[model samples]
Target: MLIDWFTVGAQALNFLILVWLMKRFLYKPILHAIDEREKRIVAELANADAKKAEAQKESNEFQHKNEEFDQQRAALLSKATDEAKAERQRLLDEARKAAVALSFKRQETLRNDAHNLNQAIRRKTQQEVFAIARKALMDLAATSLEERMSEVFTRRLREMDDTIKEGLADALKTASDPVLVRSAFDLPAEQRTAIQNAINETFSAEIHVRFETAPDLISGIELTTNGQKVAWSIADYLTSMEKGVDEILKEKDKPIAKDEPKPEEPKPETKS
Candidate 1:
């Protein structure tokens, strides 16, 4: 290499100028573009991250809402099932009550019918018995029954106790109206006189007497004064018979006991 200072200095100045030009126009512009690109990339990355976070939040909200909807559906289904069970039980109870009421009503109807039938039978029987008894008595009246009844009445009057005699005497004394004497048949003149004499002798008073025919007496004599009455009649015997008959019929109509033994029949005697 030639030792030329002038050439060296000139070449060095040229190299320095080239370096400055490259730095100002090419290198600085390239470096600035690279920094801007990096900043844009960073901004895009931040935006993407934000979007991902928002999506995740939305997914979480949707999942929570779905869970709430499922819970609401389950609650509704359970409530409906409970209501159905309650309704079914109510219907069953109502049906049972109705059945009980119907059974009671049927029993009541049966009892009423039985009672009405028994009453009707009793009334019919009583009427028939009374008719038969009256017919028999009326037939007996065609005989000397009236005369015998008069004799019996006189005897009864004679046999009256002191108490009865005193009561009749007091009634006669206090009575404003005449004493009424009722008989089933027209009394003979002798019988009337005898009755009057007996009354006067028994009471020792001049008591007025009024005789009346009463067919309903059925073979008896009845004496009434004020509210007091003294009577003797065949009807009394008939009433007793009727009562006995009623008791017998009631016993016959009673239900037999299941555990009671039946009566044994009488055995026929064997020829020796």
Candidate 2:
């Protein structure tokens, strides 16, 4: 190989100058543009990550809100259901009470009606019995009623005990007005005289006597003086009967107790 040092040296110097110019202008500019692009890409990637994170946070918040809304809705539904159930129970209780009250009222009305009917029947029976008794007595004693009654009055006066005699005597002595003798029928002169004599003998006192007929006495005699009265009447027996009838009817109207045992009737003895 021929040694050409000057030509080679000149070629080598020109090659170095070209490389320096390329590095200073093209390479450096290209490297800087690439670095800037890389930096921009990195910044964009970071921004995207941050945006994704924010989006994820927003999604989580939305999910939590949804859960909270669901819970509120469930609570509202439960509360509404409870309120409805409570209202229904309240109405049912009221209805039951109303029904019970109505039933009790009806029972009371029925009992009252029964009691009234029993009373009406009792009154009618009492009136009929009284009418029959009055008619029988009137028919049997038409002629001798007054005489028998006067004799009975005199007998009763004579039969007075010492206590009654003393009371009558005191009343006769204290009374400023005449003693009154009341009867259902007018007495004849003889009967009046007998009655006056009986009273005078019973009291052992001379007393003024006044006789009066009172139809309301109803086959009875009454002696009155100084607000004291001695009386006997058929009405007394009727009143006693009425009281007994009332007691029996009241017992019949009363309801029997469920727990109470009924009395058994006695059986007649059988012949052997």
Task: Judging by lDDT against the true structure, name the best candidate.
Answer: 2
lDDT of each: 0.80, 0.84
Q: In model 1, what lDDT does residue 240 have? A: 76
lDDT of 1 by residue, 90-183 (tens): 9999999999999998878866765676566555655565566556656766535555566677677778898988888888998999989899
Q: Which stretches of candidate 1 lie over 4 Å from their true place?
A: 1-143, 255-272
lDDT of 2: 0.84
